[model samples]
Target: MIHFDMSIFIVAAFLVFTLLVGICFSRQKTTFREYAVGNKQFTTATLVFTVLATLYGGGGLVRNVEYVYRIGLWWIVIMLLSSFGLWAVGRLALRMGPFMQHFSMAETIGNILW
Candidate 1:
């Protein structure tokens, strides 16, 4: 007599379903630009939301909360300063956007230097 775990079957089914979905939705032909940056048609609001989600997603929110609990309100000031630094870097990136047409950071740095 063999005992089988039902949860294993559920997980296997989910993995198969996810693989099928990915195969069905994947593009057949994709350029480097398209693969790297998508269509580049995102609106300002969409880009803003995406950036915000990336910044606050994963364990970042949890880590920040833990820091605040452990270290008091100064963590918030550190967060604000970090956000300001990010904003400044974003502005600098925008100014260098023209040099990044190929989406290569190395090329952009070379262009800036020379």
Candidate 2:
């Protein structure tokens, strides 16, 4: 059987590699377009994981797991409902914020392009 230390080392190495890859791409040429955006050329898979982590936080997952443990396995529905509610609210506010004000709470979500 594989030892626990081996597994931990492999996971740590993989994380270091991933961090290097993302950081290597963070710096790029500076211009009105490049400087404003700062080279956000992420792959779709990376984008998916990034969005998932941001939208469904650690607290939400912890709560859902706790609910499932107490309620005996049907709490996934509650988790889904809560996630959907948050997504709906964000979508509505973002879709409306641009028209209402120059700098909305939704603007906080966007790039400042400085």
Candidate 3:
């Protein structure tokens, strides 16, 4: 069996490797386009995962898990409601990229309101 020290060292090494990977992907940006979207190109899978994280990265998952534990199968209603909300917003959010073409969310909102 692996010793505790070995397990800790393995976990630390994995974290360092992930940090290095993120650093290596960092880019020098001079243009708004490069700054808004990174200079490094992301493939379809990366984009999909990025979108998923953006949509659900908060305590949504944890809250849903708790709801499931406490209320059992009725959690499906909560999950479905959340999914439906996303689906409703998804179209506007998608068009947002091209419609306003703003580099930031604050900029987009300001533009929409003003």
Candidate 4:
């Protein structure tokens, strides 16, 4: 008797489930501003976790774990760059400055609405 490996199947199933959930909640008719900054649906905790995740890349995460396991609490210095990068991206992603647009977000942005 031969046994079959289903690891790939399990991963694919999980990915499909997650994608379905994302598709279900994602808005189809969102404007440029709304799509960029969201509708303020995120809680403070959620925002914090998102920022943390974005700031700490995969390498940083693994390195931090390794650092903690090997040395002491010194690798925290890496957080400075991460936090700065997150701040910059967050500002750009959230703050919408005045730009050339003769119509609404839906009608002007990407020209899909226009």
Candidate 5:
């Protein structure tokens, strides 16, 4: 009598499925512009939310809450200072908006260099 672990079979099946999907959907030749920005136009609010989500995703919110509970309320002041830094960055980004017509920092730098 032989015993097989069904979990291994399930894991292998999932990996194979994911690989097949990647191969089917991936482009053979992707331009840098397309790869970087997907040639998509996003509204200001959408871009803001996307940035916020990236910053706070992956247990960041939970970890911050835990730190507040263990460390004290002063952690919130630090968070606010970090947010002020983000505000400064936003101002710089706005100033650079004209130079980023292609929406890629590398492209803008290359153009400036050459």
Candidate 6:
């Protein structure tokens, strides 16, 4: 006899659904422009949120928390400085986007040097 648990079934169904969605999306090839700038229709608020997530996602927030816990307020100051640096780089990239067009970052740098 097989036993079925409702909680386990729900989790398994969700995992399968997510796996299918990933597989479906993975089958499509992203063009260089789409890969570089994404959909390009993101509003200012969306762009801000995306940038914030990119900057602080992955283990970045965790590492920042650890640094603050270990080193105190100065760690937050350092993070603020780095965030400002990221903003400057983003601004520079926006200015350079027209020149680079659909080029990847590595390709853009190569074109500049070579």
Top candidate on lDDT is 1
Candidate 1's residue-wise lDDT over 1-114, tens digit each?
Answer: 889999999999999999998898785778878888886878999999999898899799899999999988899888888888897988888876476575777777777788
Candidate 6 lDDT, 21-84, residue by residue in tens: 9999999999867776875767999978988898789698889889999999999888777778
Better of 2 and 6 by TM-score: 6
lDDT of 2: 0.70
Model 1, global lDDT: 0.85
TM-score of each: 0.70, 0.41, 0.53, 0.44, 0.69, 0.57
**Candidate 5 per-residue lDDT over residues 1-114, each given as its tens digit:** 889899999999999999998898795778777777777667889988999899999699999999999877789888878898888888887877568566666878887899
List clashing residue pairs in candidate 5.
none
- Per-residue CA lDDT of candidate 4, range 11-70, in tens? 999999999989987856778656666655689999888877876779978988898777
Q: Is candidate 4 or candidate 5 better by lDDT?
A: 5
lDDT, model 3, position 81: 74
Residue pairs with colliding backbones in model 6 are none
Query: In candidate 2, which residue ranges exceed 4 Å CA deviation?
Result: 1-36, 86-114
The residue-by-residue lDDT of candidate 2 on 1-114, one tens digit each, is 955788889999999999998789767545664454435566889878987898669996787677788996567676666678867876887866444433344555564453
Q: How many backbone clashes does candidate 3 have?
A: 0
Candidate 3 segments exceeding 4 Å error = 1-29, 97-100, 105-114
* 10 residues in a row with least lDDT, candidate 6: 96-105
Per-residue lDDT of candidate 3, residues 38-109 (tens digit):
655889899899888986777977887888999988888767776877787877678765554566778877
lDDT of 4: 0.70
**Local distance difference test, each candidate:** 0.85, 0.70, 0.77, 0.70, 0.83, 0.82
